[model samples]
Target chain A: MAQIIQIDRPVETSKSKNVIRKTMSICPECMKILPADVFERDGKVFMSKVCPTHGEVEELYFGSYEMYTKFSTYWTDGKGALSPNVPIDKCACPTNCGLCSNHLSHTGLGNMIITNRCDLTCWYCFFYVKKGLEGAYVYEPTMEQMTAMIRTLRAQRPVPGNSMQITGGEPTLREDLVDIVKMIKREGINHVQLNTNGINIALNTDLALKLREAGVSNLYLSFDGVTPKTNPKNHWEAPYTIENCRKAHLGVVLVPTVIKSINDHELGDILRFAQTNIDTVRAISYQPVSLTGRMSKKEREKYRITIPDCIERIEEQTNGEVTKDDWFPVPTCSPVTHFIEAFTKKPQYELSIHFACGAGTYVFEDADTKKLVPITKFVDIRGLLEFLEEKTEELESGANRYVIAARFLSKINGFVNKEKQPKGLSLAKLLTSALLKHDYSSVGQFHLNSMFLGMMHFQDKYNQDEERLQRCDIHYVTPDMRIIPFCSFNVIPEWYRDRIQQKYGMPIEEWEKKTGEKLEQRLYRGTLRRNIAKHEMNQMACATQAAHIEPITGT
Target chain B: MKYVYEPVKGLERTCIRNISISSSSDTVRLDEPVDFTVKLSVAGGIRDAFTSDLWEKAWDAWDKTFRMTYNIGIKKVVAGPITKDVIKSQKFVRRATFYWSRSPELNPDYSKKIWVMVVLEGREPVHPKSVDEAKTTLFDVKKTFRVMGSDLGKGKHALKAFGKASWGRHIFGEKGNSQSVSKEITITCK
Candidate 1:
């Protein structure tokens, strides 16, 4: 028998001038879809929903109403997946989501969990040893299951997901991690990112090199803050981990799970640190922590930090180097896909996601002053982009390629002003060549001078919007050959993550008895003595180089 | 038609008059048609002083064909690569040239000299030395150009256009005079 749930909401009052928009939300307790009102009060946007059994619930939907409106313009509908795992008539919207035909976006970044077993027990983590112990299941997928998951992701239509992230309680716990990476690469996945706490990489340098050699593109390292107090999980070992990544030539993107009044204050410090070690640190993705576990309304308010709050804090802390105005929602690039499709007359890859899901921008280091420069400083990006959109229309209207190319050349100068561009940057030439000639060598040159700065705020049950779920492009592929959106999988674990894992997982005692080895939680306390000694020796070498090198007086 | 010298008060000064510009729409999609119409009146005809005397004696030197240079400026209201310093210090504009011929018989060589001039905004315009160089300066000859949309960013944008004319010397009319009136429109991209 199908379980039924009832949804209810309070009547709107005449004084509700704060309501910005209306959407659908799910009950945190009953998971019943309900009509929700999005309102603005105290400069923050909140979504209020009512479930008959669960009562009323209100959660912070957005930190700023202005930012929300600004981001809302970039919304676009996505082309549904080609090979949907679930039939449209099978069940409800989210419940039947094996990426059903109703989903709005293609999988941009697919996540595959290798194991549910984690080394440490972080109080804030969604998945921990306690849940596994209580659930009486070891939710680690076998090698076959992992491969099937990857295959399912690749089978997505229009364009296969070229990028994938291997995540877990700790993916590094798997002994065959290098082999797994190799298999993923062999399967033609262009980029394979590993999400880790950075303990194993710091302890074993060889392991880092092995993973890199096996085709691991980069490391999404957990780095909440610079100090041990805010980031107690792997504070002592982070530096060593970063040093190893640098040596192994594996780029690291610091993933900070920001909680309000906790590690939020250290955002600017983290950005500065990333800049200081710009050689190996490619980017910093500040994930405002999602509340999925049990918590009170007061607790939620105390800890919830939205994307706008993070942007504001960064601007304040960075002294306006990275301002609130510099950030843009992730789906702003939808027009690019639109233009490409019209120009090429073929189906193309698109980022047709909800406007409020994420925001990002690029910052380049000015060679002359060594100061951070936002990309907008030198290019008339808006004009060039508008011109491109116009040109794409001309192409679709039967305008010849020569005519289109000619138009591009003519308007290129208007979009990129050479004189006001960076001292060494030739934006006009780069843009012309890139747009007309299709030469991307200049794009590589641009990356050499710039770094990506972005943030993604994943939805939890309290603030989950049905619209966001329908447009979500980031997904996790379960062993059941199902591709579920990240929010649907983790936000309501019982419906997806836990349900699938429980069916495949074994009890910890049973596993221990079968393997004849007792399982224990091993917390990484820092680097080993040898690794620390090696680090000191390298530091001494650099110091010696600076000290021994003198003026040519002796010569 | 041959060049006819119109004796007027601003005849010697050479002035451009009644400049007007308009776009097909105030807002358009990224890959949609956007037509622009530029209408202007030219008076006080003059010729380039650098022409050889022999050619000047044989042809009507005073026959003026307005050489209008279109300047397009774009300001992003959303986050983009353009910085505040770039916006403040530089005129975020690009240039393309168009010529409205008054009398073809008066200057038979006008077709050869009607090539478009592409100028990088905020920089001194460098004269093209060859046809290839001139071709490189131009993407299209028409006033309308299409917008190339991408996934970089999107928001409200102010697209503006102004023009300058060339007679004997580059002529930019006074505030309310013959200068080409600048046109502006707000475009939104999604």
Candidate 2:
């Protein structure tokens, strides 16, 4: 608590073609840190930096300046980590990124890479190992190492990291994956999720049930799109994977790596698919592709898509059912955390990251019309958030706790329009329970009725803003017992991910000989890519069964 | 990123022909919405770096050779000696990035209710260049803002209004603010 930093937020005006603020950015070609200007032109935000060696470079920082300024209003500086891994005197971000003292946010969700081995090889993926490459090694940590990493995450002060995402090239490829989940649960990770392409989960019917029984909460399934072209990774098997998770009573979050000229067009259909299987599908985490390495300016323009771009496209594709105004930045939840902390008189879990990094909203099915009802369409979300902020300020200013609680109870229902709210949905009551009881079951009840749509755009070298980097909340835990931000972990793999993993990792031959299992055997021959994909209800899940879903490509 | 704006003088070819300023109300009270319109008539145009043809070649040639602002309009190549101090200078810094000479009005504060700035100017629809002695164009910009409680006191106030053409923000370590045309009106604030 003593180490928590208070972020100074000054009012700024970023109208047309104005230097919104000055920040630090690295040159793409030279990687030299230089001062950069984040400004707006033609209603778009772009970052410009002048590298001493690389000269000058400008990249689109965000798509819409209007959305940027609106989101920036909720920009809340996070409570930085109390015990930093790498203690530094000065803030040298994107380097010294082992949750340094200057880092602004604690671990909201810590990822542990179980293995760098996958079933399928995607050209755009940088997580897996390449055979015959120099210093190529199978980066699978021992059970003891994983236990130590989970313990490190649990040791975080203020709010100990409880959510763990076990990610990898393919986590299910490891034979001891269920045991790993058991170990993470044994170490007090309440929510354990497996990040996988889901070929194994779809093929092995018992695996989903086994993992669920072993304390795995959900499957962070890699589901790009519903069609073959957009989701070549798991289009044929994702339906089976969803069915297995349904049977096992496990939740699944569909992840789509959206690219501008690529699979971005299917965003609407993907949301519909989630709604169709809303019983099992909890959320759709749309991740815009982070283009690493250097490339020509023309190439970047072809595939570059920012967060607002995705939300705008979703609005257009969904026929205006879910417009851009419905979505709020991820840090909008900070007010809830603040109010709860002030009420409980202790630090609570908070998602206080840069507002530009992500945005989200929840949608519930209408009882009568069966139409998707976005939370914003019914409730005054901005008004409620602003009210919560006001109440939190009052509580912080020495207002009576019980009086504030009574005032909060009296005022909560004013923000929700009862006529527009979905039937059987009482958001005011749900919020009341969440604030009073503060338990997982209240949130679980909320998740049972609606679907969360999230947009998280990871940064690359060209568009990296160090201000956002210093406040990143999604982190990765390494075997060295240090937590790393996701951008520094994979975006600059040569520095952190690869360097540390290779140190604690072993060669492919050595790993194979020790385990007596060939690395090639880990590859799934698409056994789940059998017939019945066309007959699957996933096509019906996107709710495009009548007009859009074609018989041939499962559109 | 540098927080500076520079003004280029001797653009005698471009000067404000006429200027006027007006407010929506003769008396402004706190939290009252008032529309302010500033109009200026001027000939010629401001220099824009992006529309210039040298923008592409300036990156490769910036370090080896420098180009001065006066010789920038035309494609004629004028060379200057490369000095270490020149690289760190604000002029060189302005040349690389987009530091334009826009006819932007002054912005005092944003906590006011609303501010709508409208500018009327002309250029080629595609790749417009600053004309040295082009047609005289009329610029009318309006901003609707509310008087803040913290800004005004209960008294007779003289509101100084000026329709001037200057660099926006004027942060380039310049000596004094460049002024073109102006007027003042009296208003009572309560």
Sort candidate 1 into its docking category. incorrect
Give me the candidate number with maximum TM-score: 2
Q: List, residue by residue over B139-172, the lDDT tens digit for candidate 2.
A: 2223223444225445554443333443211122
TM-score of chain A of each: 0.90, 0.93
lDDT of 1 at B139: 23
Judged by whole-model lDDT over C-alpha atoms, candidate 2 comes out at 0.69
lDDT at residue A478 of model 1 (Cα atoms) = 89
- How high is the lDDT of residue B43 in model 1? 39
State the iRMSD of every prediction, in order shown. 26.2, 19.3
Each model's fraction of native contacts: 0.00, 0.00
- Judge candidate 2 at residue B48 and give its lDDT: 26
Write the residue-wise lDDT of candidate 1 on B47-142 in tens digits: 222122312221232111112233332222333332221111111323332211111222233221222233443322423434445433422222
lDDT of 2 at A52: 57
Question: Clashes in model 2: which pairs?
Answer: A272-A542, A273-A542, B4-B171, B5-B171, B5-B172
Full-model lDDT for every candidate: 0.65, 0.69
* lDDT score, candidate 2, position A509: 88
Q: Estimate, for each residue in A183-262, the C-alpha lDDT of model 1 and write its tens digit.
A: 89988898899999988887887888999999988899988886768877776566667778878888888899999978
